[model samples]
Target: MAWQGYPALREPGGRQWEASAVAWLDGGLWLHHSLCITEREGTVDVLTLIAPCTCGRGYVDITLDSEHILMDILGDLRPTHGRFPHCEEPLDCGSVHAAPRPTGWR
Candidate 1:
């Protein structure tokens, strides 16, 4: 199931992808992925997503403090590596190796 229904942006940088390199910061199931919003029928929920990487380097996901929550402009909440995580406060970052994400998330 290749992230069914969620909108997917191709790696902007065209670099080979590393699976499991990214994940939700909270350690839940498939929380960091481009989500398949079945309720909206094919709307990929970026809610709680990583930042839209223009550089094409994937970053790890980390929990944003309640104050750090963005208005989900694209979908839901996001902890993006956007240029402005400090806008909110108590920001966090992810640290993981470049490897395929677990198939469970797939």
Candidate 2:
């Protein structure tokens, strides 16, 4: 489950980050504007992203427990227009929710 060799961690450009961000976008989770691998240790990696809230005041840190699962979301998430573009109801402010594993993830 260790992701030391994951492409996102190895690559320089933001392609991998964009891909992951898009996946979250597709899954109705618009908590971040972008994602980057901030730290990698054995079976876990910390992903840092800018919050997409209208206020644009905070960052959302996501912990990937394994290569394919999202263990937790750290930091406060302000109220956004919607969790997803198509969402009719917005997510609760300052709430932490389970994020879906991205498709085509290794």
Candidate 3:
């Protein structure tokens, strides 16, 4: 589904990060600053923000319960990959490679 008027996340200092990706899985919503992989377990939602690591071999995986928390995580990522580039066309969330695994699969 195309998100109409997709929301942009603003840092406490007022910098804005446009949604590069967004999705709804198992009744929970997600917004990503960059390309991401998502998974859900019962009531918990885990998102892996891909390619923000300077090492080029690392990724940040986080579990969040609110959009604010997700925004905070994205804000904290500024130092890792610098400011997010302006998205000309956001990725279709439904097309994102969200692979749901069994609980405790690691």
Candidate 4:
């Protein structure tokens, strides 16, 4: 079946993009990170981060990976130490994997 939410697409010109998907990194034990692709638009030129806290806040939208997407998120997580701003829950980066598309994402 087609993706329920915004699905990955390939343009007639052969450019490809996807709307929302989680990006994962496995770091020995404590450094693992999960960069949630909460929002993607405009040929996937822009991406927004999903806050791991209980408030459901989102980070500033940024242009799609200039270098590497996972590296960017890993850098951002460094400041917070994987702690969400308004919530106690931490992202299960080690367990989370890049999945098929997410549900209820716009």
Q: What is the C-alpha lDDT of each candidate?
A: 0.37, 0.34, 0.42, 0.41
Put down candidate 2 lDDT per residue, 10-33, tens digits, no spaces: 233433323333234322333232
Q: Which structure among the candidates has the greatest lDDT?
A: 3
**Cα lDDT of model 3 overall?**
0.42
Candidate 3 residue-wise lDDT at 10 = 63
Name the better of 1 and 2 by lDDT.
1
Which numbered prediction scores highest in TM-score against the true structure?
3
TM-scores for every predicted model:
0.24, 0.22, 0.32, 0.27
Give model 2's TM-score versus the native structure.
Answer: 0.22
> Once all C-alphas are superposed, what RMSD does model 1 give against the true structure?
13.0
Mind sharing the TM-score for model 1? 0.24
Show model 2 residue runs off by greater than 4 Å: 1-22, 26-41, 47-50, 56-79, 82-106
lDDT of 1 at 74: 27
Q: Across residues 3-104, which tens digit of lDDT does each residue of candidate 1 receive?
A: 434333335456333222234333222234333447657754443444423223333353443334543422232344342232322322323324454333
What ranking emerges by lDDT with the best candidate at the front?
3, 4, 1, 2
Worst 10 residues of 1 by lDDT: 83-92
